[model samples]
Target chain A: MIAHAIFFYTFSIIAVVSAIMVTASKNTVHSVFFLILDFISISCLFIMIGAEFLGMIMLIVYVGAVAVLFLFVVMMLNVAQQKNQWFAGQQSSRHIPVGLIISTLIFFEIIIVIGGWKYKPEIFDINNSISQASISNTHSLGQILYTDYIHVFQISGMILLVAMVGAIVLTFRQRSGVKRQSYIKQISRERAEGVEVLEVQSNKGVKLDD
Target chain B: MEYLSAVFQEVYKILFLLVPVLVSVAMIVWLDRRVWAFVQKRQGPNVVGPFGLLQSLADALKYIFKEIIIPSSSNKVIFILAPIVTMTLALIAWAVIPFSATQVLADINVGILYLFAVSSLGVYGIIMGGWASNSKYPFLGAIRSAAQMVSYEVSIGVIIINVLLCVGSLNLNDIVIAQKNMWFVIPLFPMFVIFFISALAETNRPPFDLPEAEAELVAGYQTEYSGMMYAMFWLGEYANILLMCAMGAILFLGGWMSPIDVYPFTLVPGAIWLILKILLLFILFALVKAIVPRYRYDQLMRLGWKVFLPLSLTWVVLTASYLFYFNLLPVN
Candidate 1:
């Protein structure tokens, strides 16, 4: 138990620090790297807490796919080296007070919620919940995901499908200037259509364009 | 004190495992060169040790002694951090990889998913390196790598879902154990092939190696990297290739299980069998590299998005429904 608590504190500290660095970093690329570190540390926390499947999934989804996408966009745009000037512009300075006020409100709300919440001893009692030792986290997740929450699962799938189609529709374009090979057209051409035999071409130069 | 001792024991186990893996990776480099040379009818490195067995060691020594160059315009911090990230991610993924029934360092439930996630995240290394170089070729190479990895990753994910459907488990051990009667390759041959090809693309192996195309990109993302930094990418790439091969073996070829599992076959240990399978897959990877030509950029994208995406998606649907219809899915 002591070891677990030690590891939890260590990983959480790393996670929190990195999460702060993500926004505080001057370079956009460094921000992405900090975001990755944050994800990794949080995933470590997840793994330590026994939700190994969810932890690994979080790593794969956030660090692997999403973070790489962020890195790709940042690099492609060539904007990583820009100096981060917070409240540099006169107009930008006007929003600083509003941002601070909102953040303080959120901080107070979180504090209040935590302070007011009461933890019942029964919540920690294992006898009331499913036996964790008998089944892996993934097994239980699958059981509930497919059987009880099947509709929600299907809806999420639909949402992903819609997002994919929308992305393709938005970015896909056909240009008239570009020349592309049409394999069907090339393969379908017949000798009669492609070649013309003229009797007068033996004595005189053939009029190619005609 | 007891917990401290336990942690030390784990660290010791890790060191031992790491030693063998590091040695194997070195040997794999030498083997790849020799095999490729043999295929091309040329002599490879032969002066180091007997039969050039220590060529990779010599190369490592040379790299260690060489000067590490930092490009003047490059992002100095990220340029160094990129390879470290690459190497660390490559090594950490092995934590959940099972060599046998009990050889895994961490027998997590989502072992396969962890591997997938780590492999997918590999793109960040290339992107970071390329971007930090602040050069045209590396940037282009990084973009190519990012797109290629992302495209292939989608199919690989779907293919893994197909395998998981048959096994009904995400645990690597369970996936292997479920194949006791018949390896998945026999039933899911097309998925096996598709997964293998996708793995090749994911690892940026030849035929799909447009990211680091030598003739065009001039070392691609590694353009500005030198000495030890460059060597780290080499180590990470081979490690990833080996991991992919191990994954292929575990998923489709029944991992450590003997092929026939009768008489003489059952006499051997499971770990040895797993090693043999990995070696075979490595040979296949090398052979393909030697034999195939590099793919054009558009052709590679077409193969991934057009050919593989639909095929793997269709297979996923077919696999799920077939398992349901025949009631052949493994019970949890």
Candidate 2:
């Protein structure tokens, strides 16, 4: 219980700090980094909720891959570095108070919603399974995925498949003069049956070892 | 007062573990250097403190006192946070890793998943460090790392699933205990190899060290980092390597269990065996890094996506079959 509390408070602090920094930070890179921290906190929250699978997935997807991707894009663009290249107009500054007010209102609304809701965590304790229930979360998840959520699963899969196809299409660039590897032709290479060992004969008649 | 005491205790334990790791990192660095020296026919840091034991420490101290030069154009906040994230995540992953019986921070049921999560978080350091550098090479390096991590992560997951199907638990302790009779290495050799290789690629160790390949990327994502900032990356990297090797030992070599028998062998503690196994794997990794050349960018992607992914996925299917046929996995 103590461990849980420590983990909770630590991650919550991280989340709040990082979230504030994400908006307040001047540098876009800093903002993106704080976003990564926010994702981490959310992942910790998942773990605290006894959703280890979700936590792991969140880390693997968000921290390992997506956040990195964001950082890479940001770095490649060098938006922060481009600050000197462009003048900081008063346009954004003028809207700051209103943006802050709206954002804070929404944030407080979320806090209220969460604080108002209460449920017995023990009631949904995954460990408190009946003997007939699945062994682990993975087992239970797989069961639901294949049975109760089958259609939803299929639809999600389809969407991901489409996204994959779309990504391929977007990235595919055919330059007029560039050569591409012919995988089919390469795979079809046949070794001839009349494979005579070619004796390399220099004027001195040097035999190469097989 | 009680809470304060608990916190203090936690801090003390953390410090104790951390000091050893930091020292071990130094030792590993020294050992690896010496090995590389022999391989290359050159004297390594033998001149410093009788076989250069203090060299890594000296270098660390040197970095400690050096100036932290944040580039004017760079994001100071993220740049600073990047290395900390990297180092912190690496250290935290050690929490679930059991060295011996009853010697773990928290023996969580989902220890394996915790490992995955923490290791995954490690990429952020590289990404943030790169992005905050405000350099083109670093940016490209970060891009490569992101793509590589994602591609290899899928394979790693599949391999982990294969292990899980056989072990029937996500708990690291349970998995290790399952291997008490016979090491999982022999039966699950293929998965072991796949996992090890994926781990190598995941941690960005050579020949999978494309993210920081010097010839092309020019120190890659950490181009701008110098002094302790750079040292943090180095330390974080070596720590990750040890963590991976420790994990591999736990997963395959019966963890702290001696190879001999069911009855506890009085000859050596399991922790020693675990450490020795880890050391051996660490040496193998370091050796491979020293000898093997880095893979081309395209080749890396092809191998991770086209080859390793399919192989691991197929193994997952095979494992499922083996479990079903043998009725090993717990099922309704």
Candidate 3:
């Protein structure tokens, strides 16, 4: 229990610091790196809390794929030289109050949610049965995900698929006069098509035009 | 006192696993050079020790003694952090690799996912190093490598699903045990092949090593690194290659399992069998480097996306359907 607490505190501290640094950093590339660090520390917390699958998936998806794409865009755009100017311009100063209002509202909503949270008595029964089964964390999660929430799970997957297709559709373009490799045509070339057996080929240069 | 003892024991076990791995990385580097030399009909690194056994050791010493010149314009902090991240992440994935039934560090339920997650994070090291260098070639190499790894990872994920469809468990040990009757290579041969090729691409080996194409990128992301820093990248690359080889052995070749069930084969320990399997796969990786030419960037992307992605996706469907139809899926 002590070890768990120690780890939880360490990871949460790192995560919070990195989260702040994500926006506070001047360099865009540094911001992305801090964002990655934020994701990693949060995932470490998740793993420490016994949700290994979710933690690992979070690392794979967020830190691995999304953050990499973020880094790629940042690097390619050469945006690291741009200084953070949220408070610099007189024009930008007007939005600060609005941002503060919105952020405070979010903070209150999270506080209310945590303050009102309570475990139902039946939840204990469900937990008892799960522990009795002695199944692995992944197995138990799969059981619930596939059975109790199958439709929701599948709908989320479908939504992702649609989003992917939409992204592809949005970006895809066709170029005119571009030569593309046709593997079938290349592989199916025949010797007979190019060669002709002519009786008097040598005399008139095989009547080349004909 | 008891807590201290437990912590010490854990550290000891980690060292037990890590020391051999680092040593083996050194040895594998020598083997890679020797194989390349054999292919080119020349003696490779044979002067230092017997058959050039100490060549990698000697290289390590040279790297240790050399100067680490950080580029003046580079992002100094991240520039230093990159190779450390690379080498550390490469080594940590070994924590979950099971040498035998009982020889795992953390027999976590989601071991395979952990491995996947760690390996996927590997691109950051290169990207950090490249972007931090503040040079065009390294930056280009970093982008190329990141795209290549991410593209290949999609297919690798789908291919792993095919294996999971058979084993129905994410635990690496459970995966090996599920193959007691027959190795996954027999039934999922196509997936195995795609996985091997994707592993090659993931580790940035030839012919997928367009990231470090010498004729173009001049050592890729390592262009600005020198001395121990450059050596760290080299060590991390070979370690990642070994990790991939070990993954192949465990996933397809039935890791640590004796090929034959006879008395003599069974007499040898499981760790030895696992090592031999990894060595065999590593040799194939080295041989591929010698025999195949490097791929163009466009061709590499095309192969990963158009060819392997759809193929692996189809195989996943087939494997799932077949397992369902026959009721062969393991019920965990």
Candidate 4:
């Protein structure tokens, strides 16, 4: 119980700090750094929920690749921009009370809805039957993922396929001057004895430096 | 009250035991050098103590008193925090690894999963350290390291899936015990080899060590780190090598079990055998690094993505069939 509480509080604190930093930064590059922190905290929250695999995937895919792409792009674009331009209009201070009022109202509404509602704990008789109806709960997830969720997975796969194809199309422009290695040429060659008769002579006609 | 006090006493003893194990990683580096020195026909570190037993310690002391230079342009917080992140994450992975039946710090049900998670997080430190340095070489090295780590992690996961197919449990101890009659290396030998190789690459050891290749990227991702910070990365790398070897022992060599204890041949305790296997693996790793030239960056990527990834993917399917058809798994 204590561990769970700690996990929740830790992630909550991290999320809020990163979120605040995202807007508070005068420089856009610094904002992106905060954004990376936000993604990391969300991934940690996934781990606390027992989705270890998903948590790892999130870190490897989102943080490792996507956020990196963002940082690289942001760094490139933000290089010529002035830092003062970002914070000039945002820190007017007149909008603070209005923002606070709206946020507090939303917070109260969520608190009332969650705290005022209570559900009795009743044992579902279908727990064993439904569980047995499938294989291991984990295996059932995999099965459903392939069978029932097959179309959804397929569509997602297709979207990624399209994205990959688009990337190839966009990036495969010809470089007229530069040459790149051809894998076929490299793979088809074997080391041969072409060096036995080759003789190298210093240019005899060239004048030697005294 | 008595039991509570006893728990506190046990924790203290555990702390005392950890001191040696932690120090042993540094000693392994010295032993690793000596082994590789013999392999390569050279004399190893021999000045500090007999066989240079205290050489690594002496180096650590030297690094301690050295000045920690911070570049004026560097992000002070992340630059300082990055190495600590790497060291702590590396150490935390060791927490779930059992030295003996009762010696693990936290032998949770999902031990292997915990290891994978912690290792993935360790990359964050390298990335942040590289970026915070505000240097070109460090930046490029960090980017390359992050991408390479992720690529190999996929292959590692695939190889692990093959093992999980055979063992049918996630716990490290269970995986070890499942090899009572026969080690996984005997049946799933290919996966073991693949996992071991991927582990070396994951730890950024030689051939796969383009991230820190001095000739290419200067000192690579850690070009700007110095003193304790640089020491932390060095210690973390060695510590990670130990963790990988320990995991290999746990997953494939029957963790702490002597091969002959239940197999009608050997009589050594499982713990001693485990240590022996880990040290031997470290020596082998160092030997490979000592002799081989580092691979080019593109070549490393090609081997990881084009070669090991496909090999591991195929093994996953093959192992799954073997388990299901042979009735090894308890699941239907």
Could you say which candidate leads in TM-score?
Answer: 3
Cα error of candidate 1 at position B284, Å: 1.1
RMSD of each: 3.2, 5.9, 3.2, 5.4
Query: What's the residue-level lDDT of B273 in candidate 4?
Result: 84
lDDT of 1 by residue, B253-303 (tens): 999899997999988988899989999999889888999999999988899
Please give the distance, in angstroms, between residue B116's alpha carbon in candidate 2 and its true position after superposition.
1.2
Worst 10 residues of 3 chain B by lDDT: B323-332
lDDT of candidate 2 over A23-75, digit per residue (tens): 78766766787898799789889878767677877887777777767776665
Give per-residue CA lDDT, model 2, range B135-229, as digits (tens): 78887888788788878878877877877887877889988888867788898898888888888998999999999989999999988999999
lDDT of each: 0.88, 0.82, 0.91, 0.79
TM per candidate comes to 0.91, 0.82, 0.93, 0.82
Per-residue lDDT of candidate 3, residues A143-183 (tens digit) = 88899889999999999999999999999999899998886
By DockQ, the candidates rank as 3, 1, 2, 4
**DockQ numbers for every candidate?**
0.75, 0.49, 0.80, 0.24
User: In candidate 4, what are the lDDT values of residues B173-218, reduced to their tens digit?
Assistant: 8788788888988888888888877887889998688888898899
Candidate 3: which stretches are off by over 4 Å?
A84-87, A94-98, A118-133, A186-210
Please give the range of 10 consecutive residues that has the lowest summed lDDT in model 1 chain B. Answer: B91-100
* Candidates 2 and 3, the one with greater lDDT: 3
Task: For every candidate, give the share of true A-B contacts it also has.
Answer: 0.96, 0.75, 0.93, 0.11
When just chain B is superposed on the true chain B, each candidate scores a TM-score of 0.98, 0.96, 0.99, 0.94
